[model samples]
Target: MLPTYSPYEGGHDAPELRMPTGFSRNVPERRIHSHNDYWRDVPVYTALSHGVLSIEADVWLNPKDDVLYVSHSVAALTRARTFQRLYISQLVDVLERANVHDHETTFFNYVDYYSQENEREPRRLWTSFYEGNMTPIRLLVDLKTRGNETYHAVVRELAPLRERGWLTRWNGTHVVPGPVQVLLTGNGINADVRAQVAPARDRDVFLDAPLLKLDETWLGVDGVKYGWNSSLAPMASASFSSATSWTGRRTIDPATEEAPLAALISSTQSRGFETRLWSSPRWPTHVRDRVWRTLYDLGTDWLDADDIEAAAAF
Candidate 1:
């Protein structure tokens, strides 16, 4: 077995190991992004099956075509190295085979470099998700243009899906499972943002409130988003906690942070949400053992391996 992960031994003690998530993303230099069965990588997959609930992927739509592909950058979106076909299929297979895809949310993060104009162009990239019976995967569009039109494009792309009865909400938000998950990410608060790029009719999608910041009305939604790199040390303590406040560095080697991690687990458990480490390269055997120990004790939730795989894979 690979040294990074302690093969899923025995069972657990913490709160039912509820929300385990891992980004399907991977770094190219690591020989992970291009692997055909990328999800099967020893450390990555084992960690996933054992617990991961959510998967993050970066999606870039082709400038010349309506097709949207996964990859950090356009240069990485090559036909030989990556294909939209295999990317979605394999992941669906893995998730379905694992049986988590049914209820678990898949964050199909859109990372297109299109300008605000292009995003609002009313172009929608379509794909067949086997489990939902072509249910359009819930997309989290990160406006790459940084132009005022990021939200415009998000609304536009979701239009067709709305008409087809595929769209559940209009305001770029909807309930995933626990209840009415009203999201604020889709609604561009920027007045500078364009209006031509608005999504379909806008009746069902009641987009509101970013996930990272806790809104007073966040009662029904089961999950929340944390700002990408925001330091969560304040909420790291007990009392004031939410999924959005839990933190650890993506680049910090999971192996080394065992003790502090255990403390974090105990700290966060009192609040409700779990924790996960990301970024730093794989650690050695003994360190990984400690890492898993923390997982057992704390019931940590997600680990972001890298975006290279998630974006490029599908």
Candidate 2:
């Protein structure tokens, strides 16, 4: 028979153990993008907990201090919600915890063997649940300030992750996947991104290709023809409403809505770009589900979800 300890006794403390490498243990990575993730009560943590592989943050740069604040609008910006504090810092902490090992020698030996055979670096990866999955998670940055200045500020803010070699980068020939991939979007930012990343032999930052223009001749701000490729842009995204007229009724019209969307998805995928449709209908729970189901059926690469719980469940 076991004896119960008294409440006032001094021996009930929990045991201390080394932290595990699986920060997101058992949470399967999903292709859901946490839309406007900063709007959540706890931004990055909530999305990571839900196994969301992609997240979007709207950033406004203050020219005076060169600080980037995360918010949907300038009026809602706050000092405590800077991009560094909310996203970059938190991500760094998570990656550190996820990649660290209590037995360093064993981990290094294993990595070395794997690297020798593959002729490339081996990554433990951010998704700890999957043993050998090296897919990097996506962070979509929507710049709300002047294009060139804000783009530079965003790059500066990424120093922590960049210095740690945790950012996905494009080498002269191909892309080397890291734990996190930063994709730039939003107001008049194409020229700025092209100017900085286009000529570099190795660049960590990437651009989000326009989904609507993937099939057409995409011209940059400098009037140079730019092609959509995995090296330059990994994903193409657009609004759901812009692609379809269906209001999420019981059934979708085949020719007008379904066919066109499928074609777009096919086109984007053919160009080796992951497809994403944002600003999907959220009204009438069933309608949202219908649209999501249709997207999945059409082979859409990533689902833009405002409600992480519901999207995860689906």
**Candidate 1 C-alpha lDDT tens digits along 99-151:** 23224334432213222334333322222222122122222232333444444
Q: Write candidate 2's Cα lDDT for 1-314 as tens digits.
A: 33655444354442223334555778888999999787786788889888898988899998779899999898899888999999999899888777765554255555665566665667543443455556677899998886688888888899999998899998888788888999988752466566655566787888888888764444555567666666888888889988778789778989887898898899789879999999999878999999999999999999999988999999
What stretches of model 1 exceed 4 Å from their correct place? 1-52, 61-67, 79-274, 303-314
What TM-score would candidate 2 get against the native? 0.88
What are the lDDT scores of the predictions, listed in order? Answer: 0.33, 0.80
For model 2, the superposed segments whose C-alpha errors exceed 4 Å read: 1-19, 103-108, 122-128, 215-224
